[model samples]
Target: MTANKIIFYPDNKEINVDQGTGILEAAIMAGVHINSPCGGKGVCGKCKVRIKQGRVETKTVGLLTKDEIDNGFVLACGSISLTDVEIDIPTSSSISREQILTQEAKVEHMEGIISRLDAGDSEGKEVFIHTPLVRKLHLTIPLPSLDDHTSDLERVYREINKLTGLEDISTKLSTIRLIPEILRDNNWQVTAIIGDGKLLSLEAGNTSHRNFGLAIDVGTTTVVVSLIDLNTGMIIDTEASYNRQAHYGADVITRIIFSRNKQGLDKLHQLIIETINDLILALINGHQIQQNDITAVTCAGNTTMLHLLLSITPSHIRLEPYIPVVNGMPLINADETGIKINPHGLVACLPHVASFVGADITSGVLASGMYQSDEVSMLIDIGTNGEIVIGNKDWLVCCASSAGPAFEGGGIKAGIRAMEGAIQRVEIDPMDYTVRYNTISEVKPIGVCGSGLIDTLTEMLRARIIDQSGNINESIPSKRIRETENGLEFVLVWKEDSGTLLDIVITQSDISNLIFSKGAIYTACVVLAGKIGFDINDIERIYIAGGFGNYLNIEKSIMIGLLPDIDRDRYKFIGNSSLTGARFCLLSDKAMKIAEEIASKMTYIELSADVSYMYEYTGALFLPHTDMGRFPSVQL
Candidate 1:
């Protein structure tokens, strides 16, 4: 056996390794996480290392070019050292920080989540920090004498320019009109909140102390806010509450319909912004943070949320040709945008790729880190709108699916988010048919979360509780199976334990929606694979990305054909990839460039417009798919 020293260039640290081990294997053995988007399968080619000196074996490369191979840029997962050598690892956030990739299976939620799945949190009280996506700052400028005769506006720009070194500043007519009066009133000492380098708001004088910004993610049923320190980009406080838009409807289509009515759009917009401002106040008081300190904001939501947030009409987007008033918009001042962010702050929204696939997909694409590679890769943001991205450096193809809120515990009688009291994951006794579970708070069960929903669906299917066609199998001997006003359901919780127990059964209607939703996503996966002639097996690594992805069971997900049938080892659940990506974008300009590049290179495949999609979707209605041979491991 040849002797080898596995050298890590991070902090210039080095470790010795046996000759046969690959760099990734050795790195894992050494506890170094060198950003592998493909879970170190060599398909993504992201884990590239420069071999200063070494010889090694390779696994396989579906992406690396001849020039790259010749230049000694090797895929870490595929290469095994045949001799002693040095490798230079790049600086990746995954390597430099305390990376939390998986959402602990059971995290504490406030309500509507833990009890149904019978879960309990062991992670302890979440240590929260307020980190506004944007911050507003006030600066005091000294009055100019005869020696400094520069124009007031020019003089103001000088102060900010000298302070931040940002040139080519831009602002609205509203802010520009008030500049002179504000400058003189504060004796040239003023506060200004900048958004994407543009001056958003300005006040009387030096009011810089209370800087703050709000980072928001708008879901169909919920909205989350993180109040932050804009200067330091630290999240000082966070508050999440259900999206009041639920009253309009549970999903985007309903909300879009709501947007079409006269005052419906205005009401929807007002309610959300009001909710944002309310959360901002609570967070500011909760953490003793200054609201005026917030100067800028960044929001990640579906297209509908962005449209509603902007008070733009979104009904046309639901129709054919699927055009939006604006797919992506530039930065606007907080006052104009009506966000809870500091009035002086700027509100910067993420770019949207399409109507169905919006900023959330862009955020997920950035978060997945697939854009930084030259290999073939895929990023799937599973939510009400299931956005799928397939490509690497050479090409990218995208498609959107209506996966629905079922994955997030919606539509079901007792379903919730991955918050304080939700039951997240579950396992059932095949014989006795009893249940054991984990929840968010480690408290008594109340309702189910996303993971529990998938677990229940999969378990019910395997136990023959539900059939291939998603039919409730009432013919079983269990008393828990019964009919209701809403149709069939299996009794999960007794009446005493739950608020209502008509037996929280998976209904025929619910099954149809679930199947249709899951089928759309599954169909897109197959169609994209067919478009490139790559089988699901060809995907060496499968990243189930997003907040929901972290808690989803791959086995069950595959068994139900929500995802492809691959080795459990091939899948990596990346929790909150969108937020992580947005955070990175906020933190580093380099990360922002990467996001733009990802958006530009990605080719969107229109499912509604595609002719073959209907056929593919129809074929995917059965459990584990209508084509059983596609699923090799399923015993049922």
Candidate 2:
């Protein structure tokens, strides 16, 4: 009945587990994060641990070579402790908060974003003036007299009507309670934050200059927030962090499944709110601003994320029919949604196209200006769930594919988000098989990121280290490409050269996962185009939208078949278009209207229902693609 002591090195942290408990389970119970991208299914072969001095039984030593098995290496998930043991948890198996893609990447594009919204173009020449969704109107009222004694609330409403030219405006009970005091104390002078016939708040004095709004991009893995000066349509500050819900699950479907348990939905909801408020608090404290100064917020996320944010039931989003509770949500107050902004501040949840293709994609289309462009264009959001929109001003078609989290460092061994010390770029010398990698901030590589993964795949293919089938070529004469116990892996950085003090490698399994992910994305694009009676080349321009695209090399992306083999000029890396679109809606009601219109105009194509989709996906599973003719530029 005694517990087996499992000592993990070199940290020497010890956790006692029951005799039959797996090493991965013990690690989890010990508050350790091991790379189990397949959710510990024992298929990824990522959680390999060296049993230094342990008596354990392994059901299956997956992907390990004879030497590795002899050296006492076994899959953590496949091994169960039988006696007291000491194990070495390799650096490749640990998940740390060292390097995650957050706010740093957005800073470089802030001015460009501001200029685009201000000038309507990248050149910053012609200014596009527009009204924000939330407007602060200063009002003055005459003292109550016998001749005209109108109620304080009625007087304010009358003035608001005169200013906004609208009838049937609504005010919250919280705003109503403070109306008399605010009017009387300020001598009948006030500023009102009004949007879409809703009086979000009424201030005692003229606080119009201090009015602000938040534009948010609620990504599955990360969340970005932008604080804007609503008065001048300028972004004051921006913040980002990892989504707190990621602890529950990495992707939306996993989250949806996790939310089905008792109190699961509430926990997920609270986590996202906490994540957002943390960012808000950072912005407020850092910039010396008050939460009340923020009058409104607009959030852009997938339907599930949007649902989870509002605590809406997302069980059906994963089940048959895949219908969401609501696609277009009405404006709700911050207090009601538990956002720490002004109690009366409106939280305007943007309209979504469908269950999978939510407001993020819709807002992205609007932000990219593709909704109004006459020429054919496409927007591909590369992430855990890859969403694609292909169309122009006249019409639009969209689809969502399960690309897994390989690109965002979810499933790969030694994979990390785009942060400092993460390898963001990779190049291989064909002659010597020497590998050169660049980290995000020129630090030692802890893991390879999405861009670096693509670069590695392309470079490896070009160097003949891996064939089109994504299998490592053992026949190739290269020390870097060696057959490991867990299959062949190309070592990018040695233990001495890496930040983790463990070799950074991409295994054959990692290559397969990457291939499947990139294949899903590329196939989704091709299938969407084919359904439109157009080839992949027929699209005039392909706009790659995401923060991840900021580090993407168009040639390398195409070389890996993540993107289509089209003219490089036609590829536009519009960084964080979802956030950009949300900001557009935050600053301009017209843009908000356009976002709704884009959502309405888009035709969501469910790939699961399409027969041709599976075929295209199978064909795209190879390097570049099964159809070599499509990728003419790919020499391999």
Candidate 3:
């Protein structure tokens, strides 16, 4: 096949691709970040590029205004080059991996044991003491003598066995080299940081008080790291950042396709490591602690993320049967994984149940305590993918639905990840149709996030600005509801009021995407519940988990049919349950065992194989739902 040379402006990056190649694909291959929130499906219209001196064949230009089409503006994902051409990619159209949502401010809502203990509640204080996966032991040994002379490594191992009363532990060669010096430098008095089967480090002096571990929630859209003091199991601080892998694609499916190439896996692996390293640097610097003081890391994420972190190919994850390399991963050395922590530190990944349902769900199940409850309980983890777990102590069943990235603020015009300047809430006046909203930290609006999108959609439905089908009412007598280049859009913030120069608006297409996302979530819940011979109302409690769940409004979530119409009292919002589960496993051996049990015991139901799931999804495509009886509380 003949190749064509395409030159990108501003950065002046050039790449050669086969004839008829989409510009967005070329940008991806050339290591360029183009913001295509729909993953190059040609629906988002976010990857707008201007042609400088070339002609291209466009499959669809509906996203662009007539003026824009005349002015050489086109959607990169929708355009194919007819010849060698030059194009200008705008900064607004570039994907910013740094914009990931990472604030732990909302973690106060977490219902885990750690949060209760940190609050100093009497019930928690009476129940148990903090126990971490890594234990620190202080040891004093006699100086080298004929009768008592023992190798430094063996001496340390002996002391560890005496303290923990366990045999057959593995030691890293790196720890062996440090044992001789760390033991002798402190006059044979040293602290051994150890886990169940691995020796992390041997530090000089009685450094038992300095032991620490990190609990990470590695979401497809964001990465959250929590620094926990091992001695007390208290979260000292947290750091969150956008996942750098987002530059390749917003969802795991896109990344799975990207990994099919030879260097793609390595590139993704490096990006995630950099993201983790960046968070590690921030936590250490913020706390004024040395990197060596950190002993272990517990990571909770989906199956694909675990594969990418381990530099394993995830191509098969999206294939037939959707089988992954392994649902449960073994302990990996920090150095082997390129994690910027103690060289001998252990990085443990929580086990996953299936390809779609992963460690994050297992962690959420563990954190929610739904597994131990006698009454029926359900968990909904809403993110790029929606994972639903339904059951109680007796039995558990789960399923995953491709909810897309709409809820994470992808696939929408003027949409951004949950960040400081992103709008978190919304209220629309019924009479005037004027919009009122609040941004994170009271910052000027840059874009609307997931919560804000739900609120807006609900309010629009109530105010009659949008119908049950999610179509904008063009006849509405309001300035906020007006037609735009991308069909009819409701303007939330004018150019003067927004942080950016452009007007922040929600389009009809954005509403459609969100509806599809919500429909998938609700359908998954119904399908999982039906599989267990139960109705949605049979759920005694509904636990919402994830970063988006932190700020989620129950009323609005139900109003949009994203959640079931159960009594408000039955709904519980547990912020970042995945991270909470990771922390629980990090601090409690029992919690880790429970996590494994959850992964093994939970039944994974493939929704694609279920014939009824399609009917449920189509029914949920309307505002609230096609069956008004399912959502009695929702009034429109």
Candidate 4:
């Protein structure tokens, strides 16, 4: 095979490759990331490097115009080095490793016993305290006779309204027709189960023995629930399951686009509702509790997700300006939202600030104590969306970008949820290219989850299988290198060693999508922080919030520049902050006020409007970044 000596100039690193090896691949052999917004398909000509001294034979130039060619700029992926050549690789063309989302290095949960005692102390050290949400009750009343002169329905309505603060109660026609029979049979002593600002069921006499409430965090990829004992203001149980909406589309935007088709909205609605109801059934059945006992609910989710849950049309959100029908939705009944709780139970969704910065961020801010902190801090809820809250006591700012479902195992080929067989972490030998991976249960790996993906990206860089610029070296001696239809691929595992007989690898396309996903998040954080007249490092603490953060590897994440290279001690992890925040609000009215303030004070930055975002994104598409100064700890 004819070899070409491609000396990446300035750095002066030289590598010899066969005729077909890409210039981007040659650059990686020297350690660098070329910017490719369109995944190096030559569609985005951003990955231009100057061929300073050699004949470079070229094939296609999808985005390169005549002006670019005249300036000696060649798309690294499009043109091939024809001979020994010196190339001045511009720093602007480099891609850096993005900060991966991780669980906080430190856990900051309330002291279980202390929190319990504080909750009880205010109410005379009593075990029971009143939550703001209303409850259901069945009352027995005195019978009205002909001499008393009050109509049966009027008497019942007047007494019930006076006792419960509800107005002339409503019921189904069947219930209303049977009202006289029930009053006569029970001698005016009957039970009423209040739901959705109205009466749901009527029985005979006092029955408040089993009151339940459900607080759920509806993630684009997963749904979690915490069952609350409304009678005692205590969390009784929790349940989690995959969101059924994955079948439609992996990300919110994709799902929204899918929802525009015929019956897509209805299917999307039923899928999530079914997931929620299954969890409720799990909690109820596990404790031998009745479904009728659940008289109230609280839900927290991103704006697009909220729209889906409410069955609201989400087509407009995917369009320009990204407008949504409502941010802070009004409270409704369980029946209205298809929740299988008590029929008339109130389903209160946390209020949202904007289309991007929804209640999930508000709930996360509440849980992270962002509104109460005196020291400057950053709260990042790394989920399907990158919801960031930066502030302390004086001021607050928020922004959310669609990070795509890459982290949650959506876009990648061998991706799966962090389930039993999912790979959670990876460590690769630099000298030998051997690999060691940890699974969710240390079993045979099925697919790589978010944590595993972070570890893999870092390991690949450190091991030299890929350069800092995220390009694979097809010239490496290891059999892991293979020619795929998409491009060159590096196998993480061979088919014979696997559980499902599949060769697991990260493709060039995967790397491209990941770059954009993490780049968008990192650049958004940087841009938003810059707009606030401060840098990300100026904050005293960085709070990583969300379900993904609970199990991610912080060190590996930092090594990849997916997270800022700060003192590990400065980061704190709060698991499922959205749910925790809702729980706090459920336990104390004070939390609601705090949540409201966090939402009100937050200055949301729309990154889409800022053209500089792409510029920042271009700089971040490297191993640790073009400006290695930012990540002092990440060294080659």
Q: Which candidate is the best by TM-score?
A: 2
Q: Which tens-of-lDDT digit does each residue in 1-636 have in candidate 4?
A: 899888886667888888777887687566544544334456444466777898887776544445447767788877887777788765334432111111121222221312542454332322313544645566666666678877766677776787878885776765577678887787677767665456665666555767777878887766777788766666777777656675444467668877896598898898789878987898899898888878788888888888888898878887877788887666686778999987766787787777778888899887666676688888878887688778887898888866776776655656555655678888898888888887765667767878888888889888888887889887889888777656887788776776434567788777776766777677777887888888878878888888778776788777766777888888888778878766665554456656777777778888877887778878888876788998898778
lDDT of each: 0.66, 0.82, 0.83, 0.72
Per-residue lDDT over 450-500 for candidate 2, one digit per residue giving the tens place of the 0 to 100 score: 888999999999998889999999887777878865678889998789875
**Residue 628 deviation, candidate 4, in Å?**
1.1
Candidate 1 residues lying further than 4 Å off, grouped into runs, are: 1-148, 167-210, 416-422, 442-447, 471-475, 483-488, 496-502, 588-594
RMSD of 3: 4.8
**Stretches of candidate 4 exceeding 4 Å from the true structure:** 1-132, 137-203, 585-597
| Global fold similarity of model 2 (TM-score) | 0.87
lDDT of 4: 0.72
TM-scores of the candidates in the order shown: 0.72, 0.87, 0.86, 0.75
RMSD of 2: 4.5
Clash counts for all predictions: 56, 3, 1, 19
Instruction: Name model 2 segments beyond 4 Å from true.
Output: 1-104, 107-113, 122-129
For model 3, how does the per-residue alpha-carbon lDDT over 101-195 read when each residue is reduced to its tens digit?
33443463243455554554442222223567788888886677889778777777777788888688777777787777776778999887788
In angstroms, the error of model 3 at 185 is 4.5
Model 1 root-mean-square deviation: 23.6
Cα error of candidate 2 at position 337, Å: 0.9
Identify the leading candidate in terms of lDDT: 3
Q: Looking at model 2, which ten-residue stretch has the lowest summed lDDT?
A: 96-105
